[model samples]
Target: MLSKRLVSCLDVRDGKLAKSVRFVDTKDIGDPIEKARTYYEEGLDELVFYDITASSEGRDILIDVVERVASQIFIPFSVGGGIRSVEDATRLRLAGAEKVNVNTAAVQNPDLITACADAIGSQSTVLSMDVRRAEPCDAVPSGFEIVIHGGRTPMQLDAIEWAKRGEALGAGELVVNSIDADGTKEGYDVELTRRIAEAVGIPVIASGGAGRPEHLYEVLTEGRADAALVASMLHYGEYTVGELKQYLDARGVKMRMRF
Candidate 1:
């Protein structure tokens, strides 16, 4: 079996690393470049940087900041927010991002996914979905609705359906973020993650609600996720990437351990 990956997320707002609870009450924490370097040195398998306000602000992503952060990290770097076209994705790749993630713009124009995949291989195209629990209905039969603009707008799109569509559109991977569990640090929404994992053939990264090492184990195994994206637990100095990987590796979850 392929080793499960542990990814660290750096949510930036106005060029500062920030954190939020339930997609609200955001507060700047520290410098993103410093954090990126720390995590990379501590054995993080991948890093994801998101410009939380870029989409809503109607501007391009902070490329300067992305370049600065990229210069500090050696792991696979995936960037998102305000990427509207193939040109934007190419620019991010040129800025040192191995993958370009699209959320709001992809939902607005799914063809953008195909376009980016064509420009920079599908393996470099990541489809990020910010989802929330909703009443099961014909519109969202999976009971999960995709939200955009940093979870401020509901798209009424079914999470499972969108995952399949994203794969069909040539997205090489999927990041399923549960807004309901985001920043909670309690545990991942295993059911929601498993449902989407089973629905899509591409890799599924479970984002949000990672508190302890056991949570990562559950999400990686029971949740059937290819990777687990962490924020609060690692951002606050609660756990280091190496420590988390050690705990997971000892529990039979294969990890890329750097000794």
Candidate 2:
């Protein structure tokens, strides 16, 4: 079996690291470059930087911040938020990001997915979905709806269906973020993660609501996720990436113990 990955996410707003609950009440945490270097040194497998307000503010991603963070971290780094076109993806790549994460823009124009995959390899294109739980209906049979614009707008699209469609559009990976579970620190929405993972052939990264190492293990195994995206736990100094990796490794979840 392939080793499971532990990815630390830095939600950047105005070049400062921030954290939010259910996509609201966001507070500045620290400098993005400092936090990025800290996680990378703590044995994090991957790093994801999201400009939280970029989409809602109608602006481009902070390329200067991306470049600085990229220079500090040697691990695979992915950037997202406000990425609108192939040109934007190219800019991020030139700024030193290994992959470009497309969220709101991809939902608005899915062809952007294929365009990025064509320009860069599919492996360098990541599809990020902000999803929330809703009542089961004809449109959202799975009861999970896709939300966009930093969770301000809700789309009629179903989360599971969107995941499959994203894969067909050449998104090499999927980041299934549960808005309902984000920053809750209770645990991941394993059911939500599993549903999307089962519906798509591409690797799914289970994001949101990770409180402990056990939560990581559950999402990676029971949720059938290839990786787990952690924010609150790591951002607040609740746990270090090295500690989580050791805990998961001891419990039989294969991890890259590079440290």
Candidate 3:
């Protein structure tokens, strides 16, 4: 089996790294570039940087920040937020992002996903879904709705259906971020993660609510996620990538060991 990946997420606001609880009460933590390099050197499998306010503010992603961070990290990383067109994805790639994640833009114009994939290959396109639990309705039986624009707007789209559509539209991967579970550090929403994971053929990265190595193990194994996107667990110095890997490896979850 392929080793489960542990990806560190850096949510950037005004060029600074920040963390939020349930997508609110955000607090600036540190410099994103510095944090990216730190995680890379610590043996993280991948890194994801999201310009948290770019979409809501009606501006483009922080290209210069992405460039600076990408220049420092040896491992692959994805850049997201306010990427609205194929040109935006191209610019991000040119700036050194291994992948470009689209959320609001894709929801507004889903053809953007195909356009990006056509220009840069499907492997370079990532669909970042900010989802929240909602009342089950005839239109959304999954009980999970897609929230975009930094989790401030609900799109009335069903999460399961959206995941399948994203894959069919050539999205190489999906980052299923549970808004309710985000920054809680309790654990990933296994039901939400697993539902989307089973619905899509592409790799699903479980984001939000990661507190420890055991949480990572559960999400990757029981939740059937290919990777776990951790923020609070590693961001606050509770554990390093190597330490998490050791704990997971000893618990029978396959992880890459950093010597």
The whole-model lDDT of each prediction reads: 0.90, 0.90, 0.88
lDDT of 1: 0.90
TM-score of each: 0.95, 0.95, 0.94
Residue range 146-225, candidate 3, lDDT tens digits? 98878899888999999999999999999999998888888999999999998889999999998867888889888999
- Residues forming the 10-long window of minimal summed lDDT in candidate 2: 52-61
TM-score of 2: 0.95
Structure candidate 1, residue pairs in collision? none
What would the TM-score be for candidate 1 when compared with the true structure?
0.95
Prediction RMSDs, each to the true structure: 1.8, 1.8, 1.9
Clash totals for all candidate models: 0, 0, 0
Clash list (residue pairs), candidate 3? none
